[model samples]
Target: QVSSGDSSVVIDKKKDRRIRPSVVVAALRAAQQREPKFKHEAFIESLALAYDFVIASKSMRPGAAVKLLDVYNVLTIMPGSAREYTRPEFARDIYLLDQSGHVTTKKGRKMSLPASALTRSGGVLRTVTRNGQAKDYAGISFEEPGA
Candidate 1:
């Protein structure tokens, strides 16, 4: 069995290139068993590597950091270098998504938070009164255990 760590390497055989679904499932199961000890991103990254998935990036360190941040409910689908759009609506939506725990940015990576995290982070909404009044409200913040 291959040990789990940064220095570990997986050598795939060209003759037996068939992907074993069971191995992938087993890796995921093992990861799930250790879920409590890992953040969402760490769990996924560990499982992905356990199944021999290659994380493409400049270096393994950054790749791991990106993966770790992913478990924290940050979405980095769109790169920071993405072209800036002047539309207020689009900008507002992205900001709302970022604030609502749906997405988070760190070190140039976008990560998605689990639904449980999203619900816990609180919802974002704008209230408008019929009497031509509008108010912006911030949602309650949920602190993680030991946070």
Candidate 2:
């Protein structure tokens, strides 16, 4: 707001909190940090496919699970993208998948990934949980959704 006092013009900004939407958007964009684009369903589905491939070749049963390393190998073997799929990313995805409950009957359909699925069989895929707890999962098993 502007006011004419004597021979001088005074401007007051204390009450002017309004800003143009475009300007605000520009400011926000400039200050925004890049976030990871983790596609939950796609990534998880890829993981499940890789696991299936590994499990089938190994002739794994419901009580048995393919090694984490084996699954990772299957996923990275063909190099689907230019950016390499790192072990850390694989680990994080697994953790996120578990937390999502998408593979269990509790949430996603036609799958039951019990705690036994993540039991450490041999070598481990160490991951940090959503709550920041360090976890190690050696293998993964998939069962009937209602199981």
Candidate 3:
């Protein structure tokens, strides 16, 4: 299968037959579902196929960002009355930076990352919840795992 700008092709060399249009559509749909973040145009460009023999060409959706995890182990959720620290809005959005240097916006997703996920430099911005109230514990320490 090959796709170019506004064009695509599926070569069946064994039979030298063109793939059925419906099958092609199904395959593309499956591809998108399996990996929505894959760039459609880039896939076509990688194939380096000509459009003159393209059996099908349809507008494909751009890659979508998938939410995974958030950075910063703590967030300040206090309304107004701020000091100099991470903003409260940072608590609302889970900022996940993938290995590929791409960020995924995870709105409405709470940052429930494990303590091990954090580092001296980064992790999910966290605040301890006590008595149904959240409190910032900037200079506190918890027992290490198996320690």
RMSD, each candidate, Å?
19.4, 15.3, 23.1
Q: Rank the candidates by lDDT, best first.
A: 2, 1, 3
Candidate 3 per-residue C-alpha lDDT over 70-100 given as tens digits, one digit per residue, 9 for 90 to 100? 2122222246423433434233221211112
> What lDDT does candidate 1 reach at residue 40?
41
Q: Pairing residues by index, what is the TM-score of model 3?
A: 0.18
In lDDT terms, which candidate is top?
A: 2
Q: lDDT by residue for model 2 over 19-129, one digit each (tens)?
A: 555654454344333333556677666766776788679777653556777878887787563135667667767876776767643334343333454463455778656
Of the two candidates 1 and 2, the one with more favorable lDDT, higher being better, is 2
Report the CA-based lDDT of candidate 1 relative to the real structure. Answer: 0.32
Give the runs in model 2 whose Cα sits over 4 Å from its true position: 1-36, 79-83, 104-121
Superior candidate under lDDT, 1 versus 3? 1
| Model 1 Cα shift for residue 104 (angstroms) | 19
lDDT of each: 0.32, 0.58, 0.29
Cα error of candidate 1 at position 92, Å: 25
Q: C-alpha displacement of 57 in model 3, angstroms?
A: 38
Q: What is the clash count for each candidate, in the order shown?
A: 10, 1, 11
